[model samples]
Every structure is written in C-alpha cells, then in structure tokens.
Target chain A: MVRSGPYDLNVHCIPESGDTIEEVVAVARRLGYSGIAITNPDSMKQLPFSGNVEGFDILSGVEIRADNASKLHGIVGKYRNKVDIIAVSGGSESINRAAVENPGVDLLVNLNIAQDSGFNHVLAKEASENRVAISFDLGDLIHLKGGSRVQAVTNCRKNLLLIRKYNVPYVLTSNARSCFDMRAPRELAALAALFGMSGEEAMAGLTTIPHSIIARSRPPAGYISEGVQLVYNEADTGNIDEGDR
Target chain B: MKLLPPTLRARTRYLAFEVISQDPVRREDLIRELFSSAGSLLGDVGASECAIRLLAFEGSTGVIRCAHDRTDRTRAVLASISTVKGTRVIIHVLGISGTVRGATIKYLAGVDVFNPKDSHI
Candidate 1:
C-alpha cells in the first residue's frame, strides 16, 4: 500500500517554546506523523538544521514576525537562503501584502486580525503568482474558545474561499507549541472540514504542498532559479587549451 | 420491549482513541468533555445526529460509538476537545472499525476487554 506520509509545516520547539525537539517528535510519531518542521523564530542557532531525528524528518524553518513592511522585507531577505521555509506571521494589512508579494516567503501564516480576514482578492492573486502558500493554522481553532473560536473559523472559511477561487496553494498546520497542542493528521483534516476544506484538499495541504515547498526552497548545488540549473557535459569538462591531446 | 431487526438497525462505527494528558483523567470527566465539545461545535441537533457515546474507557485508551457516516464529524468533536476537568488533554483517535470487537482487536490491543476491572463503565 502506498501511503502519502503527512508533514506538519509549522511547529515550535526549544528556544521558541518550552518543549524540546525530541519530546515533540516522539509525540508526533505516536500520532502517526511522518515529520515536523521546527519553525522557531530567531533561534536557528540551536537547530541541527539539516538532519532528521532518528529517521523522522526534522526541517529547520524560521517564522518571521515583524511589526512593519520594511522590517519584514529586511528579515525575509536575510533568512531567505538560510532556512528551509520562511513563514511570515500575518497580522496587519501591509504585512500580509508584503508577504504575498515576495516570492522569498513560502507561507503567510495566520492571515487574520480581530475581525478582519487580513486577505483579499489582490493578495490572493499575488500569492498565486508568487507561489506563496497560505497557511491555515488550526492552532487558532484549538486555542481560541467560544466567540473567538467562532470568529477564527468564520475568517478561515472566508480565506478558504478566496484561496480556492484564486487557485492559491494552501497548507494546513497545527502551529503546535507543545506536544499537547499537536494532533494527528486525520484529526487535523477533520478540523479543516469545519472550515469548508474537503478531505482530499486537506491531505494535499498536509503532504503534497508542504513537500513541494521544502523541495523548492532547497535546490541542488549550482542551482540558478526555477527551470534553470548548471549542467556540465563530459566533453565540456576538459579545458579547450588541453583538448589538443 | 421488541428489538429492531438487524436489517433495520442503524449502522454504527467504533473509534478507538488515546488520551494524552498533563494529569490522570477519569472516564467521567472525559465523557463530560466529549459531550460538551461535540455539542458546542456541532450544536445540539447535530450532536444527536452523530449519536456519539462512550462505549468503553480503560486507562488512557477507550472506544467511542458513533454513526458510521459521522465518523469524520465525531473525529472533529474529539479533536476540538483541548481539556478535561481543567486538565490539559489531547484525545487522539487510534483507528475506526465497523464492529466494536474489530476496533478493540485492531486498535486497543493488549487491553483485556472482558476483564471487569478494565471496564470503566
């Protein structure tokens, strides 16, 4: 049987949160997750960066939470090549726009304010064109209660519609800070259903999109850009001056 | 009291789950939390449609009976629950089966279902 193992694109460990990476990974494995990315902001120094923990994949991601557009752009530039994933913490309108417009940013995480959805058709178009994935952080649904939870669901539903209409890539994340906050992939899919996402779409978000994002960010050495790479032919390997032999 | 014929009876699914908590949680508190979470998320009428019931709970693992078609909805209810009796908890669904026995055998392995002491009733 072929199983598309699920990957959580957003998780916190160590310096960013109280729980250690090993503890979070152990709980995630018990829940049947294939891997998890530790997206701790400004704490990349503490991560192994490129290796998996005991065969389970561990991606070193950075979550950039800045106050304004300039600062957000500056941080994105610095971390663009340093991390496997770049997620912008969405809150204000300008920050949302800046995130989607920059191809360097992989995910615009949690796109909502108190009442505003913090997203629109323009941002959706930009996200689609830039290939920036929109993140539906289900952690809000887990952490928020009563009226706030209802509000978060409503906003997510609205964002889902826009994402579908624009054909933008969207990712599902528990946004877990600890083992208690983490959930199995199936449970995450169920919570996504509460916000109008179909089972298939949820699965793609959990597996396919995240995998593609990781692959896209980290290319083989001598990589230039998309559809462009440095290739060396055997004949071209020898210097022209020495070809006289 | 007459029992409904097998052909006319409602189809049900058994979901086996495990409770990972900060503190040891009793069966009663877990049941209470399940109902409230389902009720609040799915509403009263929706909860009734799912026909969710706690069939058996032993230690941290348990089996819940729900409508066959509502398994996903029941999963959402379980996922929505973040706490039980003020203690932080996560109820992760182990697996689902058409029959309670199948669920127990497949997901609740190592637990003696027939043992009275293991029954949290």
Candidate 2:
C-alpha cells in the first residue's frame, strides 16, 4: 500500500533569462510547495540553502544531458553522498548505461517511447540485477504525438505490473517544467486513472514512492521537526495527511 | 502533418510581450506617453495579427506584448517598424509560462529577425 498527498518530485525553477537564484527561491516559497527538486543541467550552485527555506524540503538534484549515453538522467545529492535516485530523462541506451554504472542509485525511468519496444523489460532486468530501485514518469507518455489517453493509461498499467512482478520500486510525477505547471494530488490521481491505475496506486505514486526516495537520501540527523516525521508516518500507513497525520 | 485542435495547436493567440528601450534620458517621458497614448490605443483596438499591450518602457526601451502563434507573421510585423526614434528596441518572446519562464530575446531596433530551426516556439 502507498500513501497519498501533494507530492511533486520533478520541477524546473531556473529563470528564462536574467533572473537570479534569490528570485527563483522567493517565487518557490510564495507558491506554498512542499518540496522542490532543483534541476540545473550544469551545476547546483544556484539552488537556495535546502535547510533555510520554510514550508518546503529542498532536495539537491541535477539533470545532466549525457551525450556519451545520448540520454538525460537526473542525479540527486552529491556523488560522494550516496545518491538517492537516478531518474531517466527519456533515452534508453544512455539510461541503461547510467543505471548499470551507478550501482547504488535507484532508477526513475521516463516511459517516453512505445511500450512494445521492450525497454520496460530491459529496465526491470537491469534494476533487479543491479539491486537498484526504479520508478516511472507519465508526462512523456502524455506529450507523445498522436498518443491517446487510453494508451497512456494502458502503458502505465503495464509498467506498474512489471514493477510488481519484478519486485522493483516505483514512483509518480508530473515532470513539471515550471512552478505554474504543477498539478494537485487529485489531478495526478486522475491522470493515473487514464493509465489504468487504481486510485490507491496513483496515490502511492504521489506519496509513498517519493517519500521512500527522500528517506533513502536523508542524512543521519533526520529532518527538522515532528511534522516531517508525521507526514512520513502517515505515508507508511497509506493514510491521508489531512490534519497532523 | 495532421492539424491539431485549438487547445493543442500552438497558435498566435497565446503571445505576451515585453519591450525594453535603453535610452535612460528619455525613458520616463517615452514611458508616460507610450502608456497614455499608444498603450491605451492598443488595449482598445487589437491588431489583426496581434493584440499589442504595452508592458513597460524603461530608459530608452519600451516593452510590448505580442502573439507567438505565427513566427513568420510576428517577424513580418516587427520588421515593418523601422525606428524607435532614438531608442533601441528589444523584444522578448516568452515560451513556457509559470514557475519556469522560457523566453527568446530579439533586437527589433535593427536587422531582420530570422527564425532558426532549433528555436523553441
């Protein structure tokens, strides 16, 4: 069973032009976001201090456009600091290579291509073999040209089935490019229904999976307050965080 | 290619504009007149190809909002405007909106605006 809430794992806040990091942070804070995963291709220098921000847990992450593997993969936390997750930014060969090379990192496969293409099987096998966790994003499926909502739902069901069968880990996200593009938890659940996922399964994608990934990356000291713990506690029990969990 | 519906189709209707004029000495005067006159006119009478809305004119630059539906048409309209009197005109075409702002800058003060194949709409 997975928990449910407003869990947004992928968000890009970098400005279009001259806007600075402070401005970006200010905008994010004003939006009342729970967590923000900063994704700058080159470096994480511009990200605000993760601990300082209020009402949000700032996760350190990066989206690298790797040509050697010809794919985009996000590496969260520093290399020396055991990476929590490695999300596939939609490319097969490169993503596979990154997963294989980075033994400890979990895999977040962006199912951007055809389901019949066998990429899912390959990813499952690789994740199991490497003892790495895995998750998938539905944004790519929705964005595909001539792709139908039914097809997207079917693809997600197939992917989730594979995860269950292979005993691999999984998560869900909107793959948002900007702050305004963020979707509410209910919206994500509705999207899951399009992919043949039950309301519970969809809720898990938003809560449990993301919380699990964050748990893996957290330092020994733990988070700032009991409120954070309450969120995770409710998530573990697959309950809603309406009040104080 | 198959034609998409209005919701999915990227058209000229969604364009928003920002114009910057960098002449510091005439900035305030140009802005006041621009807002009171040209800005009001545009707000009242929308163009066929674009609904021009004056954003801000700071220093010698004035910002205006324009449609991004058709690049060719947008460029054509921008090209027809010759002089900004003495101010340099900088046009910024915003791509994706919200938390992430994707914009492409163009100097309409001089030179012909050319669309590159790799440019994002």
Report the C-alpha lDDT of model 2 over A110-181, residue by residue, as the tens digit: 554544423467677666666554545555433332345345556677777777777666666656554323
Model 2: per-residue Cα lDDT at residue A1: 15
Q: Once superposed on the true structure, which residue ranges of model 1 sit more than 4 Å away at CA? A: A1-4, A43-48, A221-224, A234-245, B110-121
Residue B80 Cα positional deviation in candidate 1, in Å, after optimal superposition? 0.9
TM-score of chain A of each: 0.90, 0.66
- Model 1 lDDT tens row, A69-151: 98888899988877788898898889999999999999988765468878999999999999999999898887787888899
TM per candidate comes to 0.91, 0.49
Score residue A163 of candidate 1 by CA lDDT: 92
Most lDDT-accurate candidate: 1
* TM-score, cand. 1 vs. native: 0.91
iRMSD for each candidate structure, in the order shown: 8.1, 16.3
